[model samples]
Target: MWEVFLYINPLCSFCLKVEQSIIDFTRKNNIDTQYHFVTTSNMETINDYMILKGMKPCDLEGRIGVTQDVYDASLLYKAAACQGNKKARNLLMNLQQEVNTNQRPYNDETIKLAVEKSGLDYKAIMTEKSGDAVKEAVKKDQELACKMHVEKAPTVIVFDDEDPTKPGVMINQFGSETSEEIINENLIAMLEKTMPHQISEPKSKYYTNDSIINIERYRR
Candidate 1:
């Protein structure tokens, strides 16, 4: 079993990309996995993320002025989680696609469309999204991010089933152009590092001189 904490900024392009990658990774690996998301509370972390990726502060300031949008989207994501994990993931991906892929504004209309696409209970989601409990949930996510020392959006921290107290392996700073395959590779590598026993060795008919050759070695 694995526990993955994915910290994201709803408005971040990199976050959207990594979100897809993480989804793909989870499906392909087929390990018993529980995943969670932590949303950014302020623009400071987003700014820092972009700057670390070589964005000039002056240019970035004008582009990422939608702090309120981020907060609202964060709340919506938390509210979506109340329904179920799958539905929440659908809503999150749909929302990101609308804003990042379709270039739609992250306003009420876009949010509504995303919720509809996700097959979510729109009225219930909206009501909960505005409640203090949802707001507190979002705040708690941010606090968890801080505790984990997450410095960038789209960061993934993977914990093995062995020790609950360990900090876990952190996967971060993928470039905007990073492919899902590459991200998956990184995830697998981290898993191997953290929980080697969980990874299955490929079976083969032939044996090496010393021992059976690992199928993974051929592609290396």
Candidate 2:
């Protein structure tokens, strides 16, 4: 099994499509994988990050129309992950589709709709949304991203095993017309280079305290 740390922002269109491609590629390859969807957008740096990633200022201004804060949306994503990673990933996919395809704002209403669509424990999530545990989870993810020196969304760090604490391979190049085949090939090549000797069973490790708590929550 492999673990991949994926840094993304709900407002990033490229991140949305690229993540879906990676997920599809992993499934097609029959790879046992775990995904950590780290929400990397902050209120301070989101506009600048978007522009640096090649989004035109005029277009961004038009799209947002007004100041749109994404911190709450990011926190919502972390809360969803508390329920389960798969559920969180599904919620993210739906949220991204709503934002990118339907031009929906990243707001409480949008998040509520995504939560409903994902079939997660809505009451639990809502209750925990403002709790310390959920806040810590979101903060931990952001801190991890900073520790990894991640400067952009859609950045993927692939580990040979389920533990991401160990050093991993980072994939920095994702083309405009990125395909599942291309992603699969790149991942295979990286895995080969990183894990030349295959181990029978690798011990799984969580990157943060919040991760461990979430896994336990899923089990209960």
Candidate 3:
């Protein structure tokens, strides 16, 4: 099994695509994996998102709640995560697609639509969105990013759960066609190297001169 921490901006198009690819790859392979979708609260990351969208900081002045949208989305994501990781991920993906693909604003309407589409309890999320616990969760995510020295969004940290002594592998290269392939290869290699091997004694039909013994090895 692997523990993956993916730090991303909920509104970043590139981050959305990369997240989808990673999820598809893991599900396709039926890998035992845990994903932590950490929405970044850094200004640099927000600037990068704006740059990717071909917008300057000045443009945000006219769009109300634009700057605060990032933090708001982060809170919403954390609230959604209280229900389930999948729901939280779906909410982010929906928000990204609306903002990036549909060219929609991250306002109340967009957030509501995304939450509805993500199958979240709107009442529950709203009740918990600004709660102390959710705020603490978001703060913890920020602390984790600082501890890991993550200064940008769309960063992935892969930890080999079987071997905790080893450091987590950091992946920050993305937004290229080859990024998916690169991540896929790295994940496969890590699984091969770190996944535990099992050996069991097999029932033998024939006995040897000394004993009936057969050893079977399986890699998972």
Give candidate 1 regions above 4 Å deviation. 42-44, 48-56, 59-64, 163-167, 197-220
Candidate 1 vs 3: which has more lDDT = 3
lDDT of 1 at 188: 62
- Residue range with the least summed lDDT across 10 consecutive positions in model 2: 204-213
Per residue, candidate 1 scores C-alpha lDDT tens digits across 1-220 of: 7777788887666677777777676788776787776777555665654564466656745446555677888999989999997899788888888887788977889999999999998999999998999998887777766666666677777765556544467776553344555555666666665666777433211211112122122111
Tens-digit lDDT string for candidate 3 (35-102): 88888767678777777767785575723345578788889998998899888889989999998889
Measured with C-alpha atoms, the lDDT of residue 160 in candidate 3 is 60
User: TM-scores of all models?
Assistant: 0.78, 0.71, 0.77
Ranking by TM-score: 1, 3, 2
What's the best-to-worst order under lDDT? 3, 1, 2
Query: TM-score for model 1?
Result: 0.78
lDDT of each: 0.70, 0.65, 0.71
TM-score of 2: 0.71
